[model samples]
Target: MGQQEWMTKDFYAILGVDKSADAQAIKKAYRKLARTYHPDHNAQNPQAEERFKEIGEAYAVLSDAEKRRQYDAIRAMAGGGARFSAGPGGPGGSGSFDDVFASMFGGATGRGGAGFGNGSFRFTSPGGSGGFEDVMSGLFGAGSRGGFGGFGQQPQRGGDLTSSTRLSFRQAIEGATLKLRVEGREMTVRVPAGVRDGQQLRLRGKGRQVPGGQPGDLLLTVEVAPHPVYSRSGEADLIADIPISIGEAVAGGSVEVPLLDGSSARIKIPAGTSSGMKLRLKGKGVRSSGKRRAGDLYARVRIVVPRKPSRDVTDAARRIDEAADFDPREGLTTQAGW
Candidate 1:
């Protein structure tokens, strides 16, 4: 931002903080304003967007010890005893830091050169190298990028910030509003439904803000916790292992399976169904979240045998097995060309 801007804009007032506010106080104030004016939270208010930007800019400058020092120094140098102005002369223009710097370096050396004289600020380039703005950029961190590089534009957009969160498997599939701590401050972020684990959610205008540029985004990484009874498959299907009694598997029957949505779905087990057989319930897995389509639920059947059999039951089982003459794996080797 221009010196005029830093000189005029009351950053402390904008942030509703005292000039002597401590680092913690400044941070607390900024976070409160950031949450209040966050674009997503106040989308309907154009003024809030602008206010949010202002709050960020103030925070960015004040939060950094070095930048804060420079800012205070600049303002101090511009106050009483001396006045700042363009086109040298006196009070209104001369006798200021600019005039002192010019005098220090014999005559107005034009832009683009190397270090000059004894130990007087070891800069790579002899700074008087460009427009007046370039000179300003060198003294104060503004107008140019890479700071002392050269004078051209205002500060670039604020840097992007990163944060992470843990979500329940169900929460990952269903949209949720999350409160997260970012850069040691608390802010609210939205997690869209159907968000896969390891995916990132970008919260716009929710990052650091440059003095005179666009605010950056907050990149949120999501992690879904594992579920004991259910798991997510590559096809977005929800899976579960269902154990059924031998009788239920041998004769077609209905089995109630748990769903990710905390509900139960009844699936039919075909007659003579074997262990490891899979049953599917279309559109019964994870419900649609955002643009994701509904997913299916797959249940793998596991047949449980009776731990102990009565003499009569054992005899009846042997008779039934003898009558059925079926061996599911009998032709496995022949099919493999054994």
Candidate 2:
């Protein structure tokens, strides 16, 4: 095992947990710490978000069994009998393992192996060394090896920054662009058409600056505001309750209903349409970029009763009840309690 700063960071300590913590325990600790240090929750404190990021990175590694093993191994090796000996009268004299570890991993010479900077550790092996590169490659593949610090060699894209955005139900369904204020800069980002609540939208190359590398992305987590009259059922569907008068319910008529886009459409109410009857309007709901087709809007019919009934209305109802020969609950009774 090779010693690395990341290994010595003690992610478990940062999250305030023991190495024996289970997945659920790790997750709970991470969430608690994340909430405590979250940028939104700790606006005035500059270190809160950074600590939160640390917690996230810690959880990202510790949550996985293999990663946790590697991390533990690196920490053990870093703190073990690997004291820094002046590399045959090198620059620094005999020092603690920290100095040697730092000199070797700090990219001071960039001679290969792994280098640590920009809050992360990079492994660039010079062909040989029983380091993480070999273990990671054997366990995963070339793609996975890229994660350890080799492969693509292309400058890595900056990490995606996350923030939350609140959208009205209509806007979530109709799709809208949001102006996000991140790091004191306002950036206009497109919220894809038919985005759902809690859905994440990735805007590539919109994150923090990386030395000699392209900027990262901005990841927006959307929170859709509840609407008084409308609700979302899925990625591309809108649901609403439509009220119909007694006459309209019995006789059938075209009634206007509001769509998600703030537009109204006339839907034909069939004769004898009962309360709770659902009607679907094709292509009147949310629109998805991939499908390029609008989802159907569902309208549930709810019969509206008159607040004040006139004598004529009462008499007509009485006459209709008296004229009806069929009992609505005829089959509900059991024969002799059998």
Candidate number with greatest lDDT: 1
TM-score per candidate, chains pooled: 0.52, 0.59
Worst 10 residues of 1 by lDDT: 116-125
Off by over 4 Å in 1: 1-155, 306-317, 335-337
Which residue window of length 10 is worst by lDDT in model 2? Answer: 138-147
Give lDDT tens digits, candidate 1, residues 199-298: 5566888886777687777766566778776778864677788999867877779989977666888888899998889898888776655535678888
Number of backbone clashes in candidate 1: 3
Off by over 4 Å in 2: 1-156, 308-312, 330-338
User: What lDDT does each candidate get?
Assistant: 0.66, 0.65
- How accurate locally is residue 78 in candidate 1, as Cα lDDT from 0 to 100? 58
Give candidate 2's error at residue 323 in angstroms.
3.5
**Candidate 2 vs. true structure, TM-score:** 0.59
